[model samples]
Target: MAPILKISGLSKVYDSGFTALKSVDLEIDKGEIFALLGPNGAGKTTLISIICGLVSPSGGTVVADGHDVIRDYRAARAMIGLVPQELTTDSFETVWATVSFSRGLFGKPKNPAHIEKVLKALSLYDKRDSKVMTLSGGMKRRVLIAKALAHEPEILFLDEPTAGVDVELRRDMWNVVRELRDGGVTIILTTHYIEEAEEMADRVGIINKGELMLVEDKAELMRKLGRKQLRLTLHEPLGALPEALADHGLELGKDGTEIVYTYDSQGERTGITTLLSDLSQNGIRFKDLDTSQSTLEEIFVNLVRNQQ
Candidate 1:
């Protein structure tokens, strides 16, 4: 199937002579949740803004649901909904009015039924009559989501959707995002919360310094790059690693009371068996051992650090 959103050689340069995006090419499949992970000043928001037509690209093309974002601006933008990181709603407007107004901005007809469903889905139905200022921070965020969905967009861009929300509200937002994706709305979200992307995204894209570093299936990314560490507690403290075990990539820690071995998780041979046999041959004794695998957060940090 063709991607719902296609970006080819997209580049964005600001008036201040700063390049916010650099030759980014990506394709988001229909109905899939794609998480874009990046550090500050990493062009994530710039890319999203260009796609949503809030910002124009310096070069290349962005196609949204078969419409060119630049040449067919209205048609391309009509299929996209964006919830910005900043809170920019009118404080005096009632929840229902604000969301309804959003739909009209896209030239969509007044559809009370659709608005009500969006409100209820985000748990904002009860607050529909309440003024925007009267609601809490989390509720206001939900209001933003409701407004985004009011137009019934085929693609949604959630930029820090749960920024100021509580833990419970963050989980609630995750459920709402999943529901949107399940209902055939393609989602692309940029979040500082690495765990959110880990929990929700089917595919993960890591961006750094205006360049897309890697984009891959979530599980496959983890498996291919993830590393495992095995730490063995020594029965007798060793001052240093034996010459025979030097090839095992071992580290002596805890004042020489622990032996640490790092290995590729995806490797056909982890070298654990050989290392263990070598340890026995060298008369090295261990009291206990523990194993750990690298997480998505670690992978994200390492990627960003490498780019730096």
Candidate 2:
């Protein structure tokens, strides 16, 4: 199937001569949740802005669904719904009023039922009559999502949707996002929460310094770049590692009570068998041992750091 969105050689340069985005090329499939991860000023927002038609690109092309964002601005924009990082709703407007107002902005006919459904989906139905300023921070965030979905766009862009939300509310939003994707809305999310991407995204893209560093299936990326570590608790605290273990590149724990070995999971030979044998020969005894794989956050950090 053709991607729902396609970005080719997208570049953005500001009047201040700042290049916010490089030649970024990406394709997002329909009904999939794609997470774009990056540090601040990494062009994530700039990229999203260009695609949503809020910011024009200095160079490149963006096509949403079947419409060219540049040539068919209105149609392209109608296919997309953007939930910005900051709240911009009118404080005096009721929840229903603001959300319905958003739909009207796209020249969409009044659909009370659609607005109500969006409110309920975001758990804001009860607050529909409440003023925006009266709701708590979390509810305000929900209001933003409701407003974005009010127009029923085929593609949704959530830029740090859960930035200041608490853990429980954030997880709730994750579930809501999944339901949206299940209902056939292609989602493009940019988040500082790496775990959010790890928990929800089917594919992950890493951006750094205005360049898209890498994009891959989340599982495949983890398998390809993830490392595993073996930690053994010694039966007795060894004052020092045996000289015979020098080749293993082993690290002694702070108190010398633990032994650590880090190895690439993709390696043909992890050297575990040899390390164990060598340890036994050198009179090393372990009471217990455990292994752990690198987390998405760890891999993310390493990738960004290496690029720097």
Candidate 3:
């Protein structure tokens, strides 16, 4: 099957000689939750803007649901729902009216039943009659989502959807995103929250300095890059690792209370058993031991750093 969204050699260069995006290429499969991870000014939003037609690319082309975004702007845009980072809405407009108006803007026929369903799906049914200005920051963010869904777009773009929201609201938004994906909507979200990507995304894409660094299946990415650490609390303080144990590359902690051995999680021989035996032979004992694997955050940091 063809991809739901395709971007090829997408480049954006400002008149001032700054290139915001450089020969970026990506393919988002239908119904997949693709998360775009990047730090500030990394072109995450710029890329989204180009695909959504908010900004025109200096080079390359984008196809949304088989329609060229530039050549078929109307049809292509109609198939996309964008929840921008900023909460921009008509403050005085009641929730229901604003959402209904958005559908009309898309040239979609007024379907009150469909609007109701969208409102409820976003948990805005209770506040349907309330003005947007009266809602809290979190609720206002929900209003943005409601307006995006008003036209029933096939692809959703959520740019920092939970940036400043509280924990409960953030989780609630995550649930809504999952529900949308389960209903067959292709979701592409750009977020700073690594845990969010770890919890929700099917695939991960990392960008930095206006370039696409890497894109891979989330599980495979973790398996390929993840490292494990074996931490041992020493039974007694040691001045230094014995020469016999030096080959293990053990890093002694502060005050000689702990030692950490780093190794690849995918390795057939973690060297844990050998390290322990060697420690005994060298007369170094440990009080307790534990192991930990690298997190998505750690992986993301490493990717960005390596790209730089």
Candidate 4:
């Protein structure tokens, strides 16, 4: 099946001679949740803006649901819903009016039932008659989402959708996103929270310094980049790690009652058995052992650092 969205050789250069995006190529499958991860100034927002027709790309092409974003702007844009980072809305307008206005701007006929459904989906049905200015920060954020959904686009772009919201609102938004995906809406989200992406995304894409770094299945990425740590709680304090264990890059705790061994899970050998045997021969005994696998956050940091 053809991708729901396709970006090829995409590049964005500004008048200041700064390149925000460089040769980014991506394909988002239908009904999949794809997370774009990167540090500040990594071109995440720039990429989204270009795709949503909010910003012009200096080079490359983007096709959304078989419609060219540049040539078929109306059809391409009509199929996309964007929730930007900044909260810009009609403060004086009631929620219902604002959302209804957004839908009409898209040349969509009024569907009061659809509007009510969207408001209820985002938990803003009660606030429909309230002015946007009177709503809380989280509520206002929901209003933005409501406005975006009012048009009922097939693809959704959420750029830092949960950035400044409280935990409760964040969780609520995730639930909504999951519901959208379950309903076969393609979602492309850029987030700073790795845990959110880890929990919600089917695939992950990492971009850095205006370049596309890596894109892979979330589980495959984790298995490929994640490492395991062997933490040993010593039965007795040690003055220092013996010379024999120095080559293993073992980390000694300040109190000398703990030792940590970091090893690649994909290697031919994890070296745990050898390390333990060597420790026993060297008169180092441990009372307890614990292991941990690297999380998506760790892998993401390592990738960005490697690029730098």
Candidate 5:
């Protein structure tokens, strides 16, 4: 299937000669949730702004659905909904009015049914009559999402949508996002919360220093990059690792109560049997052993660190 959004050789340069994006090429499937992860100044927001038509790219092409972002700006922009990081809403307007106004901005006709559904999906239906300024920060965040969905966009860009919300509210927003994706809205979100991406995205893209580092299916990315650690609790304390175990690159754990071995689970051989045999040959006995795999957050940090 053709992508709902396609970006090719996308480059962005500012007036001060700073390049915010560099030759980025990406494709978003029709209805998948894609999480774009990056550190501060990594060009995440810049890329989103360009796609949403808030900022112009110095070079490259961005196509939303079947419309070119530059040549067919209105058509491309119409297919996308953006919830920016900053809270810029008509504070004095009621929730319903604000969201309704946003829909009209895209030249969409007044559809009270659609607006009500969006508000209710975000748990904002009850507050639809309340002034935006009177709502709490969390509620206001919901209003932003409601506003984004007002036009019933095919693609949504959420730039740090849950930045300052409480944990409970964040989780609530996650559900709303899932519902949107489930409803066939292709989602591309940039988030500081790695777990949020981990929990929600089908694919993950890591961006660093304005470069597109890696993009892969969530589970595949974890399996290919994630390392596993085997920790063996010792039956007796050993002040140091045995000379024969040096080849295993073993690390003595706290007070020599355990031995830690890091290995790639995806490799053909993890050498667990050999390591165990060597340990036994050296008078090492393990009482218990457990394993753990690297998390998405860990993989993200390592990738960013390597780029620097």
Candidate 6:
């Protein structure tokens, strides 16, 4: 099947000679959760804005569900639903009224039942009649999600959807997102929280300084880039590593009472057996040992740093 969203050589520049995006290319599959990871000012939002028709690109093109985003604006936009990072809904209107209005704005015929379903899915049904101003910040965020879903869009873009929300609400929103994906909605999420991406994304894309560094399947990325470490709590403090242990490439901890051995998981030989045998020969003994593997956050940070 063709990609649901396609961006080719996309670039964006500001009036001040600031390039917000480089020649970037990306494709989002249908019903998959793609997490866009980046530091602030990395063009995540700029890329999204261009696809949604909120911002013009300096070069290249975007297609959403086979519709040219620029030439066929209405058709492309109708397939997308965006939940912005900030809350910008009308404060005077009731929750139900605002959500209903949003769907109407998209030229979608009035469907009270669909509106009710959206509200209820987001746990906003009970607050349907409440004014936006009276709702809490978290509730307001939920309202934003409800509005986005009111039109039954096929593709959803969530920009930091869980930001500022409590743990419970965040989990609740994650469930909603999964349900949407299960129901055949393609989701693209940008988040500062690496844990969120690790927990929810089928694929991860990393952007830094307006350039897309890499995009890969979440599991494949971890398997290819992840490293493991073995920490040995030394039986005795070592002033310095002995010359015999130089081949191990071990790092001494601050306290000198611990040593760490880092190795690649993809390597054929971990060298753990040799290192242990050498330690025994050198009269070095470990009181205890612990092993750990690199997390998605660690891999992400390393990739961005290496790109810079």
lDDT for each candidate structure: 0.93, 0.94, 0.94, 0.93, 0.93, 0.93
Candidate 5 regions exceeding 4 Å error are none
- Residue pairs with backbone overlap in model 2: none
Question: Over 4 Å off in model 1, which ranges?
Answer: 268-270
Give TM per candidate. Answer: 0.94, 0.95, 0.94, 0.93, 0.96, 0.92
Per-residue accuracy of model 1 over 1-308 as CA lDDT, tens digit each: 99999999999989999999999999999999999999998999999999999998999999998999999999998999999999889899999999999999999999999999999999999999999999999999998888889899999999999998999989989999999999999999999999999999999999998999999999999888888889999899998888888888789999999998888865526488888889999999999999998889999999898878
lDDT by residue for model 5 (246-279), tens: 8898899889999998988655264888888899
Tell me the TM-score of model 1: 0.94
The digit string of per-residue lDDT tens for model 6 on 13-52 reads 8999999999999999999999999999999999999999
- For each of the candidates, give the backbone clash count: 0, 0, 0, 0, 0, 0
What CA root-mean-square deviation does each model show from the true structure? Answer: 1.7, 1.6, 1.6, 1.9, 1.4, 1.9
Model 3: per-residue lDDT, tens digit, 1-308? Answer: 99999999999999999999999999999999999999999999999999999999999999999999999999999999999999999999999999999999999999999999998998899999999999999999999999999999999999999988999999999999999999999999999889999999999999999999999999989888988888999989988888888888889996998999998855527588788889888888888999888898999999898887
Please provide, for model 2 over 40-73, each residue's C-alpha lDDT reduced to its tens digit, 9 standing for 90 to 100: 9999999999999889899999999989999999
Error of 1 at 288 (Å): 3.3
Deviating ranges (above 4 Å) for candidate 4? 244-247, 268-270
lDDT of 2 at 249: 89
Which residue window of length 10 is worst by lDDT in model 5? 264-273
Tens-digit per-residue lDDT, 83-202, candidate 4: 989999999999999999999999999999999999999999999999999999889989988898889999999999998998877998999999999998999999998899999999
Provide the lDDT at 196 for model 2. 97
After TM-score superposition, what is the CA distance of residue 190 in candidate 1 from its true location, in Å?
Answer: 0.7
Give the 10-residue window scoring lowest on summed lDDT in candidate 2: 262-271
